[model samples]
Target: MILHTNDVFKVTRPEDIFETRGRFAYFRVELLSQKGNIDVSLKLTGRLDWTFTRSITLTRKTNDKGVAVFPVGRICESLIQGTKSNLITYVITASEYDHAGPALYAVPGFADREILPEWGDGENISQFYPAAPCIVVYPNAGFEQSLFFPKQTGELFVLTPSSTTTEKYIGNSAFSPIIPFDPAKIPSEDLGKPLAVGATPTDYNAEIRTYYDYCTKGIFLKWTDAAGIPYLYRWTQESKTDEMSVESTYHQLDDTLTPRDVQNKTLAKRYTLHSRIVERDVFNLCRTILGCQDLFMYDPDVGNWVRFMVEDSESEDTGAPMQDLVVEIVRYEYL
Candidate 1:
């Protein structure tokens, strides 16, 4: 049997890990004591540069093989990614035991080991790179959430009724009793033009039309107060129509009646918040925003700046004393 040191605590997972999505990433840590696989409570503290430090407690116990295992739950990837230095340092310790160990480092996203500068002789060398947008999510009230787009200024379009195909009857239906109808012998004719009225009984055929709608039912704008608390302001239908024009032709009629024109004809119903917007607190903002099931933000998976909604808050957890907000990517946008 080998003797393990009391200070043999270390993070076993997430080695050199980088998270692109703003979802929770799971990790694990291990601790060893001189007593050989004894049950012990350990504190795991994660520090992200000078911005903030979050710590969670875990109990490590011996398994059937007398080996200790301590698996941590999902950790907010955004909180760990926005560090100034882009490095997250973790330390594990136990009050009753002397198993305080060296700190472990985890890096978020891709980072070059060395950014070598190009050598220039006499002329000034200019390097151009695209700017990445910064996105942040905070609570508006209780569970309601709001997003902050520091670099985004243009209007965002939220699509609805994803289906683009619609059916409309073009032929007149004639009365038919005991008509010898064979499903396999159904006539296939041009459904675009109106069918002529005939005395012989004929079934009314439906013409399928596909189109996309540019008119939005509503708009939710993200705003902040003097205290920097985020809130979502829903735009009225009129306001949405005005903003809709900036992105689409709201009143223009299509000559050919495209699929988009057909979709635009469908109107969306108005939505009302259950609770007064003024009565909501900042913590409950996410709850209210999520309650509006019809609303959808931009996707972030394909762009540098991704929009996320607050899924959970760490302030309520006693173990994690830090005020870290957990957010998941809702939408992605390039610009």
Candidate 2:
């Protein structure tokens, strides 16, 4: 498989992302020697040679399905991303003593491959009929016997595994099942106003930004000041005093402008005009202008949450117009 650093392979104890949204999902690893039942536990390793150093014991028994469920014992304050570097290590050995054992599995190439392909590829779990339906109520809440997720009360959805479009929604075991986009209606009229379409109880901030390659050093942005002079802001992360811990930082680059560009130029004039260099305040600029930043934030802690982006020229390869700057807003909940 083609390995990519940005690829994510979700890991779980055979549950759904919606079910394990706010927790670390783990699997039940059992050891059985010729002597009958051999005790074994699971461990975790990281990029820095960091290891859990403890064998997490499994207490559940394997049913006729050969599937075993185990309780994590205590709530864990950890978060695992399919696209990150943290690896899950399963160690099987005797649980009675404090000794290391064989490493059952090591996710050395997890970042390059999807741990749960059927689940990750938008395939429905109901089609596969998993070992058992498991959901995570909260992070570090420990593995509980029963859990519940929110479901629409009166929503009608077609479930046909054979037909792709009119097909059934798979993986409905999560707290929130996927809502298929309705294609039976016409496009909503653009009333020349901004509309919000994303997660609610907003947990982010919005800003208009511009980014260009920083030669060969890194990446920087151009933020317009009150005088319309662009100022360079080096992207970085900081702590937010909200719900979780420190949140992801967004690099905001917004500017206010008059409707001068759109007002004077005629329809024909706008089409005929070519390249023009406009001057603003003095700030360092980069060589390659990446694109207009609709919403830009970088948290050394939190990661990117960009749902989509609208290009200026209606083309992915072009830049935005002069009069119009990027507009980006995000909802954030403080820790």
**What TM-score, over all chains together, does every model reach?**
0.26, 0.23
Q: How accurate is candidate 1 locally (lDDT)?
A: 0.29
* After superposition, candidate 2 runs with Cα above 4 Å error: 1-55, 70-85, 93-327, 330-335
- Which 10-residue window in model 2 sums to the lowest lDDT? 266-275
**Could you list the CA RMSD of all candidates, in the order they appear?**
26.6, 23.4
Q: Write the per-residue lDDT of candidate 2 for residues 45-154, one digit (tens) a residue.
A: 22223443333344444444333444331311132333232223333223353333222212111111122313221223232121112111111211111111112222
lDDT, candidate 1, at 105: 32
Model 2 clash number: 29
